[model samples]
Target chain A: MDRDQANYLFNVMRLDQGASVTLFNGRDGAWRAEVAERGKRGGALQVAEQTAPQRNPPDLWLLFAPIKKARTDFIVEKAAEMGASRILPVQTEFTNSERIRQDRLQAHAIEAAEQCGGTFVPEVADLARLDRLLSDWPEERQLMFCDEALFDRPSPLTNGDATSSGTGTPWAILIGPEGGFSDAERSRLHALPFAHPVSLGPRILRADTAAVAAMTLWQDRLGDWTAPNSDPVR
Target chain B: MDRDQANYLFNVMRLDQGASVTLFNGRDGAWRAEVAERGKRGGALQVAEQTAPQRNPPDLWLLFAPIKKARTDFIVEKAAEMGASRILPVQTEFTNSERIRQDRLQAHAIEAAEQCGGTFVPEVADLARLDRLLSDWPEERQLMFCDEALFDRPSPLTNGDATSSGTGTPWAILIGPEGGFSDAERSRLHALPFAHPVSLGPRILRADTAAVAAMTLWQDRLGDWTAPNSDPVR
Candidate 1:
């Protein structure tokens, strides 16, 4: 441990030689560790057996048009906590943010993963244009296009929606920036067969809030986290 | 308008006479206003007719134990965006935040409401002890008690669970602190008739993420944002 780390563990946290702590390295599952040596200069931790197996979220990705600095970081953090497999920043026609610091955002994702006790840290891909992503879109993967204009239609892919509520499919959620999608982009997304448009709610949510809301709706509707509705409302 | 406001409207926004802007004052619905005068020190805005009627979310409240400063602000902002009627920062046995600045948090709610195009701003109630609030809880208001411990149960109050999934009911969502609820508090909540404990998911979510997640689930499952599931899966 470094000096600051030693001070934190020894002085602040008051950890003794035999004290236990949970540790994870993103690749391996969570493991138990104990302080092997405690000194004023530094400390040594002895890794013990695994405490829990690695658990990953469903094959879910978050594709968002980057906004301001703080909101962009908030999206990445929430995406990690919501258990997204990967996070992709897409540059749309109306996207205001010209560029994003990938390293800083990736670090935020890592910190969020640690905070939420997530075994897997979602990879935050570098910024890419929306058109390029669409051109190279995976054929089998589906998209939950959160368009508030589609408020008249039922948003959730509930068990009742037999046609589109297909479970176990690789999925992604796209949240537009505050400026919203351009007419051309909206038309294209609507035309894409793989893109399933869904409404979040009556009152519109900001992009950051929408990210978390969309993930929750997806998890409730068709993701790995299933809330079994004995009476499934479509 | 004040001097700063005049400067922002005339200089920054480059607005001249007859430029239209939307306005709201919590109680009034959205209105369109036009610049009547462009003075150096101040400006004038002539109010037009109301454009949109007053709209509000369902009678849903968010009761959460306060955490750190930034996170508490996040919860309030998100609660407003997600359409919570009121936000109550409760003091649980393990709650870390001793107090909160209600005005500052309320300002966040106002900003979020405006960003979301919401006419009605949610109220941020002063910090109150959890036990006292629970004792005086309105019998009519149902509580969506979010507990990580109940991870095994189906969390959503879907169409099938008629007993607990009653529509048009006054409701509140409770998110515990980082240290979690004391056993006594959990037991009391579990025993309460009005409190319905629900798990967020298998992977634990931080308090801020949980607030948004829970609100989304409530909106989808039972709030005014009825997702008219054609095949209602119970």
Candidate 2:
């Protein structure tokens, strides 16, 4: 531990000398570390053996257009907590913001992981153009397109066996801006063979709420929530 | 619309004279109103015929212990947007905050309804003691209690005809504070015939994220999201 971390652990968290704390990196497994020294600014930690094996989050990626700063932060934080493997900020036609603070969003994701006791932290990608992304879309990955207009219509998504394919198939959840997808964008997305237009519900959910609801539904049906991982300890 | 609303619409939203806007009062349904006069301080609108009938939100209620100010506001707003009919703030043993701004939280709910184009606004109830509330619990209402410690365990909840009883049976989702429910509280809740202890997912979620996730999962499995309403429009 460095000076700032030592100060935080000793002062902020009120951990004393010989206090054991759990630590994890996105690559390494979770470990138990004990405080070796108690100092005003700097301290040392004795690293112990791994407590839990490294576990990757779901292969699901969340692609969303950035909205206001707070709401965008909320989306990133919630997506990370909800087990999204990666988060991509896409610039759509109706996207209000043209730029995003990638570092800040990544930090928010990290904070969310820390708060949620998640071992894996999802990577926050830099802003990318939606058209270019769609043009170079991967053939193997299926996109779960969240359509705002589809809420008014009947829910075409039946919960029968959407996740029967298991966790091997790559997946992505796409959420549009507050203004929603334009006619051209909606049509192109709907026409795509890999894109599956899903309705969240009958209500008109805000962009942030839609992102969470979509993630929850996807996790429940198609993600890893139903199947518990084997030989893993919390 | 009043003077403040006029200033907001004309100045903030940049709506000009003769602009058409939708209005809803929860009782009269949604109506198309046109600006009759535009002034610097005030404006007038001519209310047209109702465009959509009044639609009541789901009978599902959300009971959560109040946390931080912004997060509490977020819970209320999301509960309203996610089709919660009633919002109740319950005080648990580990609840950090003892008091809450009910009016402010209610206003947040209203603003959320307005932003999400929701015709029905959820009523935010005053802070109630959890034990007292549970003492007089309704017989027909089913409570979905979100247990943090159960995330690592198997999900005992089954979707098989759980909501088949239909909308006549009331339902509520309970989310604890960041500290989570006490062992005594969890035992009591699990022992209740009406309360069903459900796990959200594998990951540990923040209180606010837990609220949204619980609402989403319940809505998908056992709420009105599975069965759309008839006749009434958004």
Q: What share of the true interface contacts does each candidate keep?
A: 0.51, 0.57
Model 1 global lDDT (CA atoms, 0 to 1): 0.83
**Which candidate leads the pack in TM-score?**
2
Highest DockQ model number: 2
lDDT of 2 by residue, B136-220 (tens): 9988788888887775544434643345555557788899989989888988998998887778878888899889888887777
Residue-by-residue lDDT tens digits, candidate 1, B179-224: 8999999999999988888877778789999999999988887865
**Clashing pairs counted in every model:** 13, 0
Q: Which residue pairs does candidate 2 place in steric collision?
A: none
Interface RMSD of each: 2.6, 2.0
Candidates' DockQ values?
A: 0.47, 0.58
Q: Model 2, residue A26: what's the lDDT?
A: 76
**Over 4 Å off in model 2, which ranges?**
A1-16, A38-41, A152-164, A230-234, B1-19, B36-44, B152-161, B230-234
lDDT of 1 at A143: 87
TM-score of chain A of 1: 0.86
